[model samples]
Target: MCRLLVMFVMFLIPAWALGAPIEIAGRATVVDGDTLAVNQKRVRLWGIDAPESAQQCADPHGKPWPCGRRAANALDAWLQGRTVRCVQRDVDRYGRSVAECLVQGDSVNAWMVRSGWAVAYREYATAYVGAEQLARTGKRNLWQGAFQMPADYRRAQRAMQGEDTRAARVPPPGCRIKGNISSAGARIFHLPGQRDYEQTRIQLHNGERWFCSAEEATAAGWRAAKR
Candidate 1:
């Protein structure tokens, strides 16, 4: 009986260790609320979604601005010059590796949700539901004011891109605008005197429209182009 027990324990140990931990070291370039580029490979942090640079939600003052930047800044400060360890889980639709990253022994994804800089992406996994709920109740970070769900934010973005047929079917008249793209075969028109000319350039690609003044456009969601 002792010999049999020893063999069973050995077999269980190998199964537990099937997925060995891998350490990847690189500088992080934040892509958006949930993604980063490490050594040129895209990595989506598991269990969280940070706002996009163009995503607008109100602040504590009820004013709107690019809220995603704060999350990015937090991530940058947390891992800017440090080497991080990423434990892989799976790959996402965008071909990004989904993983939990650790910096200085802290779970980066959990930190984002706990601080309210991001929402828990429960569709992929439910590991951090409690942390996300805590952040929501605490009204931390992006949760301080009225904000759209991350999934909704992404859906809105897809609609703006004409990717979602249902979203494309509806014209965005008074809705706050986000980012835009312009390319060959697409013509976008704008008033010349618009104050948000710079933002228009960034948010109103070649085929979208903003039926408001430039100031309104800026408030709505257009950001000045980076020099």
Candidate 2:
């Protein structure tokens, strides 16, 4: 039962779930840079974000390396043979529990940001700002090189997926709308001028299909992008 669930979430609690926050502790499974599965609950560290595992970043020179994988590896190393505990702080749009986690009383969130394996998610909280500054100043881990901000990387990935419909100057026949699956498994549609339109490359191999109109997409079970 506890072993079957998996999740990814982001920050700041609503007034209701704050008091007597859910406390979870267990062996952890690393889902990504900032996500962990503890007691079978997918817990997203509140107020921090790590690069996606597939993302590549460059140094000052024109070079490319797997910075995203590095971030994930850093977290995995930090969690090795350790007991992880987290207090649920909130719930995200994706239904993941947003929490501040610790390993042997050390704030895992703080360590990740301070060590440059993660960044402060300013959109959520200011608790990790000081640590983030230290990481920036020291040029530790991810701070040592040129990398896309996690949020930007996500947007670009989403956009790139949208460009897969035709892969040419023109879209395939009438399938101009881009239907991309997000990391959360949501089906999103991208149109011209949308953030992901030009970058999204449709993948027919992934069961991703194309639509011709907003109405057609809506009818086929896709929603428009909020951004």
Candidate 3:
């Protein structure tokens, strides 16, 4: 924003302008259950959150299943040989586009939640509440058995890793991400070129693992360290 525009918005204007939603149409690659890659842009599905690829949760019977991976596979099955269309909402902190996407005229995000493979991220939006309620009423995916909410699962997993402090967060051979435990009991991935990246050391026993990209780390339930 221009300096004048910022000042105007802060002091002179009573309302802020909202950008018109953008439309992206193309073939897409499934980044995960809730994210897509279209025309070289990352698009996070709006209003829903899916399990991380490496996350595990118990079934109604208390048996463990790769629910996260299952969610990804479900999305892949839904998108196979299909073209994707997305209406952009905003850019996320990571700079990826957040969007409501459609495949073959069906709302992809809504389907995921309605079919029980995902949950409505109420922290973001309530647009999918009806679909989510239906899934729950039908004892759908995550509801079919007891499981942690996606965000809660991520938070708890990071906390466990952080409390261990016994292993290194292995960046690929040249990856400079500093996997460090935070006081909040979170395993934080510090990227290369950040101020504290060099000072953070790796410990082999803290359940440290290597990730080739930030996407991989995030999909595996790790969060980036704050600047």
Q: Report lDDT (CA) for all predictions.
A: 0.71, 0.84, 0.83
lDDT of 1 by residue, 42-130 (tens): 88998777888777889788999677777787777767668777877877887778899888889989988888888888788888888
Candidate 2 C-alpha lDDT tens digits along 1-227 = 34333221212444344465688899888898899998888999999999998988776575888888888888898889588889888889888999999888999999999998899999899999999999999988787778889999999878876675446345668778888778798989998888878887667657666788999989988999886
lDDT per residue for candidate 3 within 1-227, as digits (tens), equals: 69989787667533224344578889888888899889898999999999999888788898989998999889989899588999988779999889999988899999999999999999999999999999999998778888889999899988877755533544457655556666676877878788787777776565555556788778777898777
Give per-model TM-scores.
0.63, 0.67, 0.66
What candidate 1 gets wrong by more than 4 Å, as runs, is 1-22, 163-227
TM-score of 3: 0.66
Clashes of each: 4, 16, 9
Name the lDDT of candidate 1: 0.71
Q: Candidate 2, which segments miss by more than 4 Å at Cα?
A: 1-18, 166-227
The lDDT leader among the candidates is: 2
